[model samples]
Target: MEIFIVVLILLLSIVISNILSRLIPFVPVPLIQITFGIILGVLPTGIHMPLEPELFMVLFIAPLLYNDGKMTSREELWKIKSPVFLMSFGLVLATVLIVGYIIHFMIPDIPLSASFALAAILSPTDAVAVSSLSERIHLPEKIMTLLEGEALTNDASGLVAFKFAIAATVTGVFSFANAALSFFVIAVGGFLVGAVLALIIARLTAFIRRLGLEDATFHVLMQIISPFVIYLVSEELGLSGILAVVSGGIVYSLQSDYSEPIISKLKFVSRSTWSVLIFIINGLVFLILGLQIPDVMSVIFRDDTISNFKVLMYIVVISIVLILLRFIWVYSLWNEKWSVNESIEENPNRFLNSLLTSLAGVRGAITLAGAFSIPFYLENGQYFPQRDIIIFISAGVILLTIFIASFVLPLLVKNKNIEADKNSSKLNQQALKSVMNAAIRLINDETNQENKLAASSLINVCEKIKNDNPIDKEDIKLTIEDRKIEKDIFLLGIRAERKEVRRLLSDNKIPPATYEKIDNSLTKVENCLSKPPIIETLNRMDSIKNFISKFLKKQLNVNPINIKDIKKIKVLTSKAAIYAIKEQINDTNKKASLAVIDHYNDIIRRLTTFTIGEDINNVNKQRSKLHLKALQAERDQVQSLLQNNEINRETALKLRNFINYMEATAIEEQSF
Candidate 1:
């Protein structure tokens, strides 16, 4: 019952933390969760986890770190590998040595080994916390990647160093040679284990795909289990579990057939799952931190031997040191010959960007894990010197850093090159122009006389942008109105002709061969009209038109085509052009459809343009024009029937109407 209640409470805390995160924009999520946790801890009926330090560390910290490795971009990490290596390894070691020495001097009663252990534990930064903060603040990608990569690698490094330091304290022995050899073995062994495992999994996936049993559920199951398996295998081999996960992620990414349909579906599912998991984990961790505050404060107050005021003062001072040290390290490196961005072209904003990067270094889970992992006792049955105090100080620093990053960082840094708000409008304008151009090129390429009217209608649409703003509010309304009218006319024409054709066939007035042919033709037109206009075609048309317009303006002596004039021409020629254009449009559409069946290379491109619903209207307009031409061609045939006295003027007129309807339907079917 107690266990159940505790679990329920923890889950509730997580939910509350997430809600608070959404509500508050300037406060870091972890901090909010922690505050909630502290309130819960102070309550009379609050839940207590009673977690064993090692179990807690392994369960929470290990998976969190492993997840970070899996999501990080490999190519970006490789670009700044040098700095990431130095910061994760060299800087962490330096920080440990310096902090250890200071602690030993200030607290004479504390063992040097225990002091070093504390320093080593505190050295690694939290990748999750830093990544979350960086994303919100719009931290430069290069710097964020550098920090994330370093944080990920150093978790393993820091843990290894802490274990070695604890061993030295417990066993009363220290050997530099042993430490150096163990580090190399662990890091190298982890990489190998991860790589081999990933290769095996990828091969298995390929085999399954070849067997035609590639399902999203199976792929998702593999994704869920891969990280845990990689970590466990590496840990069993006395290697870095974090590095194993990192290596596996890189290998799997390289080997997997990500383009497969099943794989794409799995990716979407996996990504959403991970996002929710990370959010809950981070929120719970912070909330737990907050809940533990009252317990920590009680310990400080109850123990009269250590002054509570002095302990709080030390925590505040050390946090300042941590923040300042990061700035000093980054800025000093920036000034050196081996500085980041030194090889690139220099700019005044580079220093400012680097400063913002340095300021973004906020501590969270890694610090908590390290502080919590401190041993309770020294070699001689004495309490680990200042262990409780160190944990308290680390927690305080984490809160302070979160505050500064959330509120202060944004004020200090501004992106000079481009703002996100401005970039959106620019991208929209570029996209609109590209689509208009592609439509015009498609129309102009028509070779059949029957298709010319449809082509001309499309040309008018493309040309409208020349005289009017394509993106203007009023222009968009007008364009939409024209589209609506075209759709209605085309659909009405299709319905009227389909009814007439069916009636003629039912009455047996038309021959069976002619009836079947007309029915098939009407079905094709119906299918074409059913689809909506292709947004991609519109975008591509805009691009092609803009390119041609620019080329003509710059290189050609001829004046640009008047888009307004084209629109007017379409309106005037619509009735006369319908039949012949409808037939040509139908032929083109049939060619495109057949091309797909025959596996023609350009079939996909042609079908993409021709199948638009708006093209139905465009086809109808062309057919009206073509019908006029066809009517002219059939004049002799009609006159011969009249001269032979086989048909009266009334019958001839009805026959002409039927022919016109058939041509209109055909043209409307294939406007692309």
Candidate 2:
């Protein structure tokens, strides 16, 4: 139970951090999460969660790498493959060698092997952290892609080096030639193993389908578990599990069926699942780092050999050295022009770009995980030399890198475009309007009476979306009279719905629970109509609004309604509201009154369909099909618009996603 509570608390912190990051967009999410973890560390329920390297890799790294591999564009990766390889492998090796010596020279107490291990741990750059930093400002597409690709492969290279260093430290042996040979075997072997396993899995799935067994969710689940399965298998075979998962993801993407509807659905589900899984895992990594900080720092501070000030200096020096090394490496690569998408002639400021890239090499999860993974005890049964201090320094480096990147990168690369965003929003509304119109056309053409009636109700819904989505500021400007008419009609409609609910509840047609739910909903709408205010102002406003209602409450002393009357109550009340609007309607308010009347009439139609409860299964099936067809029409229209350049890719994507959600909701409703 305590364990369960701890898990809940950690999860709650992640949620709170997510909220804080959104509310404070300038602050990166990982920083917020780390802060929360720091706060939790000082609390009574301070968590000291163990960080096992093998478990961490399997749970977080493998799947995340797999997803990244799957999503990376093969063409784009191919274009900059050389740069990516150089940075991921070459730069990583250089950083480990160069930084390792620097650390050893600075802190002679830490052995050279231990220093190399720490260096290896910090070698890999975090694309995720860079992405978080880039949320507000877009990095050059060329640099972003290069960073992403480097991050993908460097995890394997850096960790492989760390493994070698750790092994040397444990057994008191070191050989560069043997390690290089072993790396080649492990990398190639892991790649082959993952590719083979993915092919086997894909073939097995096809065989199952040939046997007339088809389930998208089942296939998607298999895909979800593939990384873990591949990782374990590769590790068992004495190979690189990281490379295996990466290759497995790439191979799986190649074998996927792109044109099939079921495959599309599976992809959607898989993407959503991976997105959520990666987010939580990524968040927990930083959170756990923050939790571990206090313990790591405490050990370092308590040591007689090292002063707290020296430790701080070590962190600052190491962090600065790493950044300088990165800047030098990036600067050297500029001779090749880094195969950037933009021409050098167009954006000739190469030095600035290199510096931005250098700043962007932010260390994150892998670094923290590797530091913690350092064995507590050596092979001779003695505690690993300066293990806590090593972890502490590594943690400090991660924090400094992220901190620097968050504040520095935005200033270096200015990509925020307010006008572009506004234009995109207008385009999104245009796409939505086009799609809704297409859907309305399809529903109007339906021949089946019941299907038409059920789907026809959605036409108003589509129209409302179109109307509410104003394409320009001028379209949203409403006159005082118009606002007054809208407010009055909304209040009257709410009162009618409330009256119906009370009449039914009093006659025992709906139980107390249902009445309470309905009453609460009506109260919410009323509250929205009149904004919350101070007690005196609120009371004054309520008195004015309830004057007529107070007299009507006294007149509610009437006979009980029958079951048949209850069945017709909603439709009858909607009609009553419409009639009341018409009675109060004048030439000046005709447009506003008709708009409200249309909404009430929609409620009547929906109620009428609900009252036809007989043959519900058939009705539901028809409704589902119609809903899906309408959504399909919307999707087709979006595609057409994209092809015509009526909307940009981003706007079309948003519209398609909106339609996809509605389609998913319809399918979910049908399933239930």
Candidate 3:
């Protein structure tokens, strides 16, 4: 139970970090989570949860790497394959050899193999730490892609090195040939296993969907579970679980079928789930890292194993060595105008790009986790030499690298010139036209009066923006009036549609999965409605009240609320009072009926529109303007609910991401 509570605290650490990141943009998220985790570690209930090597590799590293592979464009990775693979494999191997020698030299008592293991632990550059660069900076696409690819693959390479190093340390012997052979088998076997698992899942999922058995709940659960399954299986097969997960994710991503609307909706849900899950995992990784450090500290300081000051010095020296070697290696590779992408001329500033790449090598949670997992005792039963010291030094290097990447990387980017995306404007224009075409199609195909009215209005608005055709003032007003009518009728349509879905479910015409998917959309729309039903009713009631008051003041010569009938209602058990109340009600009802009649009867000349729902636009502008705003509005509603703690984080992120994709579509449409 204490372990469970400690786990919850770590999860809370993730939440606290996100809120803190918003407050302190200068401090990176990893630091914030880690700092808070440290604070949590000091509490009375603080439970030490040390990571075991197998568990850390499976639970934390595998899924993260797999997701990284899934998100990364295979085409982009291929283009930068030479650089990325070299960095992932060759650079990792080189770092292990050099850092092993350096650490051994710094502390002669530490065995050479143990030093190599320490080096391997710190080899993988953290992708999560540098993820924001794509959103924050207009870095050369190729450079970012190369770095990301290295991040995805380097863990496997580092783990391979670590495996060999640990074996040498345990057995008191080393073999270059055996190490090389093991590395090849592990890497190759892991990839193949992942691919095979992914293919099986793809076929199974598609079959399930075809049979209409693929509920969004099930789809999302399977996706989240598959990485773990792949990892464990690969490990059982004497392969790298990290590589297996990565390959499975990438393969499954490519193999996925989201052709059906229901399937597509489920896919959206899964993506959103993954996004939020990733965020929490990222937070936990760093936060738990901070928690583990104190335990490492206890081990180091409990006995006079090494001077704390000397340990700090070793950390500083080792971190410097790692950074300098990577920078020198990357710098050496950038002589000519390297061509990765034809459209993106990223090689113009080769020197600067290399500098940025080198600086971006931030060590992260993986390093710390690996350090913690170092065995306390070797195979011979003697204590593992310098285990505590290795952990302390690794922690120091992680912090130093993160600080450099967070603080210094931005400054380097700031020095570079940023160019406007000329191509973006052209893309936006194309998107506007597509919306225009969609509008035209809607107008032409739909028999409904409201859709046509909204579509026509959208077309006119789009034409004016495009300078293609000018619409008359009368037509514009009528279109706007049509939209107002559509808003008024939208709820009625929603209720009716909901009734139909329920009816189908009761009659067994549709499967529960289908019902669920459709009903979920309906519920989301209902939850996200800007105005509640009662509010709309109250708005109408207010109008009715005002109309009655005006009529009484002008025609009956009395204030409506203060009239004799209304005043008599205050008398208890009076027949006249009851009669008066009835009269007041009748009068109010009459006025409301008259006002509603007037509202709908107002003739908008030469206008046609859908009253049930307004098509915000029939033109290209709809994508960027009206429809885009609607998507944002729905997401905003979800966000507000999430902020008020009305919905769970999982639900909030799922809804927000679905809306987000629509917004992205709009942005993309406009871009093209």
Candidate 4:
């Protein structure tokens, strides 16, 4: 009951924070959640959420890092590989050493090894937090990409360095050669493990699909566990788990996700699942961060509290060192001996770009997680040196860097616009015109009315695209506004698609009954003609959602529950789940008609369109037969498998691909 209540409170806090962020656009959702988490801790209820280091790392950060790697475009990253390395490894090492020395000097009582551990904790930048900040500011694309790319690899690098530092502190030993060799072993070993694991999983995915054990539930389960699996395996081998997860994610991207997706629904839900889960995880991490202060103070410092005033001074100075070291490193090396950043270096605003990138190095959840992971006791079993103070100082660094980076980053980059090469736009326009001209010529030469009509639509779209100026110079403020509006429309976009009727009644919310009048409607929208853009947007959204959902689902173990039932109960995809909920709760009369495509059959010398003429309707009436044929085929397949002992009777009974078969038939029957 206590656990349930705590969960409810946390959920409510997140909900409230989301609402407040939408209502009050100025403040980020994370800042609000942090405040709430801190306040919740101070409440007299004596409730404190357990934020065990192992649980947080394995459960939260691994998936987050994996998602980051999987989403990254290998080609793009390769293009900027040099700068990314310079920033990730070169910048990280510099910050760790410099900041370590600064903190050590600030308080002579703190050991250099402990100071380096703190340095490691503060080394990695939070790409998500940087992105949120840059949304408000117009940092150059190159700069933002540099920051993001650096962030993807630096967490592993920093964490690896942190391990060595911690080991040094624990055993009171220091050897540069050993440390360097260990770094090579840990980093390289982790990459191999992650890469091998990802490949094995990719092969396993095919086997799972072949066994007919593919569904959304399985997809969600696989996604949730893959990171932990990678992390745990690496750690068990005494390798860097962080590196393993990162390597696996990037490898997965190159190997699997980039393929043309078949399952639209799975793809959609997979994206939503990761996005929402990562969001919640990060938010809770910050909140949990705030909650730890009270615990650390009461438990570790009960007899002798650290000097808060001196600690505050240390935080400010160390943060300055962390920020300044990057500036110096980038400034000296950005153009000095580098071809990767040649264009960026030659840019007039190069220094400003460098400055923003340096300042945007905000320590985030993983930083705090690293700090918290420091064991309470050393080898002697007395106590880890200055453990509580390290946590406190690390917390201060996170807070300062986050605020300065979020607020100050925008100010620094104000009025600065980053763009691609000038020839890029010209090349794009040339490509568009080249295609549009061919399409128009084909339409003009064709004798078929359907072809001409389709050609005309394509021409109009091209003209509109050219006229409306589809490509806009990257404008941060305007871009954010557009995103917000698009988000709004998406959330409120789809129509009330359910209709409860046979001959007389209308109740969208009620279940279908034999005696009672019952009618079911798929997704529908009103005024599609008038709101053509919105309709197009809605269609594109649905198709993407469908493809992604199906793709992700097919990679998982087959679940007993049907997709419709899974969708109704909360789905793993929070966005889709929300939409489903809205549909379930709302009662409205919504009707839809498909975009009647008039396809021309050259051999038959006739135009076939759905519901256009009596003959056309008759021609399209084959849809039902096609649907039935697919169903019968599924039935036969399931029976054959059961007879062959390939599947148990229990599993055979639940083999439901009827929905997919029907959808495929609908698509097939639409052809001329």
Candidate 5:
């Protein structure tokens, strides 16, 4: 019942925090939530929520850190690796030693062991908190990256140091050699375990994908299981779970092909879900911090046995010292030239940015959990020294930092506009568009010419036959000379059209849509022209006609014509061609129609390449006109052949009719 009530309150707080976040964008939501928690904690109802520090760390901190690590750009991380590592690991160790000593010496009432534990708990910065704050501010990417990276990496170091300190105190022994050796083994061993596990998981996932399983389910399961497995396994093996989780996250990210369709979809879903969870966790932690304020005050004030003023003074002093110590430590590194910026102002601002990174260090769940987890007493009945005082101080520092960092730091920095690297990106996009447009134009033009020539040849062959002559099938055959001439003319037209489209594309007059429509029509024509003309295969003729209709629909931007419409046109054309061929008709209509169809296809292709508003150069339009001339020449050849009886009149009529169909289709399609 207690657990359920706590959870309900946490949920309710999250809802309220989200609403408040929007209303007050300048103040962070976490800070607001923690303030709320502090208020709740002081209530007479005694609404205290207990969360085991270890469990909370694993469930919330681990995933949040893992995500921060993943999103950090690889190049930026590597560039600042030295400073990041130093700040996270070296500074954490320094903070523990320095602060622990100060607390012990300045306040004799606090035990050395307890001081060190408190210092250790406070050593590591919260990556989740830092990252959240960074996003809200206009901090430089490199600065944000350094802070987040340091926070993430230092948590493990700080935890390890804290454990060693605790062990030394409990066992009444301190050995530098053993502690150093243990740290080495735990860090190295945890990393190795995480790496191996990550590799194995990557391979297994790839295998699963190959087996044709649904990608969504597999990816979701991977997200749910990977972190826990890594942490638990490493800990069970007597290695650092923090190191293990970090190692696993890095290795898994490097190894996995997140570009795969399933993985991509899963990533989107996981990111959205994880973002909310982390927010609520941080919100609840902070809100609870706020709720504890009244209780903390009640304990100190009501219990006159303890000096409330002195305690408050000590907390203020320690918090100031902690904040100052960070600035001093950061300043010491100034002489080292850690970054490209040589100017003192620039370098220090970078350092300052890191210092103020996530000011809302509201020591929420972790501080509370760690403070509460203090060993009650030895069997001899000796009490822990200043345990409650340490808790109060830690909580105080968290509240102080959260408020100052979120509200104060923004005032310190000068505001400036920051823009993305747009010049390079713009150039790249333009280059890509140009190349694609060129390729499209080239293909469209060539196909168009081929269609026109085939039409002309068919018309010519039909005109050469006579209807009244004795049905001598051998005479019906198209002469080699005639076939060769037709093929040459068709090939020439295609070449001319290709050149013209290229010119128009260069000029930037033809729009992409215009090019696409013409290209599609040409593609259909090419397919039809590839096969020999066969009267029995009326379906093929239907297909060719359908292509023409589709081309027209595209040009006119009209609703698509159905297959039935295509079939009807094919039947009509095929019947006319057949009648002309059987009667040896002298119309030579087939040859003319074929030629026109070929020319029309070429024109459409050119139009598609010539981006209407784009090509100001007039190059593409001029080239298109040249190809049109070539088409005209072929049309004239078909006319000559028909007049000379090389094609019968019926065939000529059929060719003319086909040409009309091609013209109308191309015109309509081009309009679209």
Candidate 6:
């Protein structure tokens, strides 16, 4: 029960942090989450979330590394293997030797081995944190790749070095030759074990398929658990569990058939699952660090030998040294002499790239976890020297580095070319337009009139298809015949909206959360449309009650719309509506169908006739105005139908609600 409460609290903190992040977009999410954690620590609830290093390794670190390994581009990794090795292994070793000595020299009370241990743990950068930060700023491709590759490989190397240092400290003995041999065996043995296990699992999957036991959920579950299994097995055999998981993930990636339809379906589920899992784990890691920090600080303050200002200065100095050493190392790798065979010497961004790399090498929970793992006592039954201080310094460095990078990286990135971004945006718009055109053309080519009409009605709702001329408010004079046609369109439109949202989800164009929101809205509208008038009224009442309940509990925040994409969808939908209406004109009430055709034709005219030279903001404004007019016209038609006794109360009410929803969506889009 205690464990459950702690888990619940951590999850709640993550939710709050996400909400705050959306509200305050300027601050990086990791920083906001850490701040929340700090607030939790300062609360008087006396919450103490203990950091269990081994458990943390298995639960969080293993899966994270596995996912990173699988997702990281194999081609990019191969292209930059030399630099990756330099950063992951060489830089880590150098940091340990140089920073370790400097730390001991600065704080003579800390034994040399303990100092090295601190440096070793801090050497590994948190790529997850850096990746989150990089989302706001466009990082150079090579720099991003190198950072990811280094982060993937360095965690294991850093942890291994840390363990060796810890051993030396506990036993009061050190052997370079023995340690070197053990490191080689540990790293190699881990990779071999991981690779073999992955191969075995692949074969096992084939065997299951042959036995006709093909379940996507079962396969995904196995994949999920494989990292933990490989880590445990490797650790049991005294190999590097971190390396094992990484290698296993890479091996699994290599063996998987991505082109297969079944694999594509599974990828969708797997991607979502891993995304959520990583998010929660990453959040909990930072929050738990925040929880542990208060106790670590109190312990540091209890030491009368060190002043608070001096301890802070120590953290500042150590952080600077780490960054300086990393910059020097990365800069050396970027030098003309170092790149004699490579064309990288001519790249003008080398200095900034090196600086970015150095700044990006911020330490995270791994450092604190390793620090927490430090032995409490040495061989002589005396306390390990300055253990609490080491943890405090580690915690301090994590916060300071993240805070510095949050501010500094963006300033550095501001110098990046604006034209490149504009060109990219232009290309995206063109691609979206092309996709919309192709979808319409596909519908136009359909031979069966009924099939085309059905598809057209759906495309109309989903794409918000508009025609050339804006219908006058007085133009809509619904007869019973017109009402029946409009009812068919409305019912079909609801179904189409649901289908299109699903298609967008499957295509990975919109996120699942966005899909869920739009689907829920459409579902409620559908329920109201399908029910009897009394039930429909009751349903509306229930909806209002639920809305109030939600308002009192959680704020409903909708995702922002891309006006360009919405406009493209509308254009395609209009074309579809025109094609379907022309087909129907030959079979249905000619006058009523013509009026509907005129309504859509007016939409197309407004959408297509807008000045091409206008700025995007002007265009968006014009489009929003047009959309609102269209929505109001729709509401007017529904009202006309009700007055003519064409649609009953339930149908009229549902149509009005649907129009209201669309108008609300358009208004929200205008803000963006």
Name the top TM-score candidate. 2
**lDDT for 432 (candidate 1):** 35
lDDT of 2 by residue, 434-480 (tens): 88988886776663666765675677778987877633322342222
Q: How well does candidate 2 score on lDDT at residue 235?
A: 97
Off by over 4 Å in 5: 1-6, 44-46, 257-262, 288-298, 335-365, 379-381, 415-672
TM-score between candidate 3 and the true structure: 0.67
TM-scores of the candidates are: 0.61, 0.69, 0.67, 0.64, 0.59, 0.68
lDDT of candidate 1 over 109-176, digit per residue (tens): 66888778767776777776786665446444466677788888887787788888888887789999
Give one digit per residue, the lDDT tens place, for model 5 in 404-451: 777775665323111222232232233223322332332233334534
Could you give candidate 3's per-residue lDDT for residues 1-672 as a string of tens digits?
977877787777687677676567667677777778777776787756766756876787777777887877788788678888889999999999998899999999889999899999889988766663333333555677777888888988997898788888988888899889989999999999999998898788788878878678997898888999999999898998888888898898787634454455565567668878877777777777788777767777777756878887888888889988998889887644443333434336767777778888888877877777777788889999877788888888988888777778767765653332433333333333443444343334332453445445545654554343111122322122233332233333345546666666788865664555455444444433334334445645754875685676688664323222211221111222223333433442433323222322321111223231223223333434555444433554454343322332433443443343334334423321
Q: Give the TM-score of candidate 1.
A: 0.61
The lowest-lDDT stretch of 10 consecutive residues in candidate 3 is 564-573
- Candidate 1's displacement at residue 424, Å, is 7.2
lDDT of 1: 0.60
How would you encode candidate 6's per-residue C-alpha lDDT over 1-672 as one tens digit per residue? 987987888899898887776577578778887887777887898477778999988998888888877877787778788898989999999999999999999999998998999999989998567656665544555676788889888888899999999999999899999999999999889989988887788778767867887777887888889899999999999998888988888888887754344455465556657767877887877787788888888887887877989999999999999999999999988743322212122334668778877888878888888999998999999999988888889999999999888888767755643324434333333322332343343333331443444445434643532221111122343333255465455445445546665767798977765565555655554454344435546755866985786675466565454555555544554556566656655555566567556655665675678743436455455545555445544554454343222333444444554444345445433432
**lDDT digits (tens) for residues 550-639 of candidate 4:** 577577643323323222211112233234434533222111010010110221222322224544443344433333333443444444
The C-alpha lDDT values of all candidates are 0.60, 0.73, 0.64, 0.60, 0.57, 0.70
Q: Is candidate 4 or 5 superior in TM-score?
A: 4
* lDDT score, candidate 1, position 571: 27
Q: How many clashing residue pairs appear in each of the predictions shown?
A: 49, 0, 13, 20, 74, 14
- The CA root-mean-square deviation of candidate 4, after full C-alpha superposition on the true structure, stands at 14.9
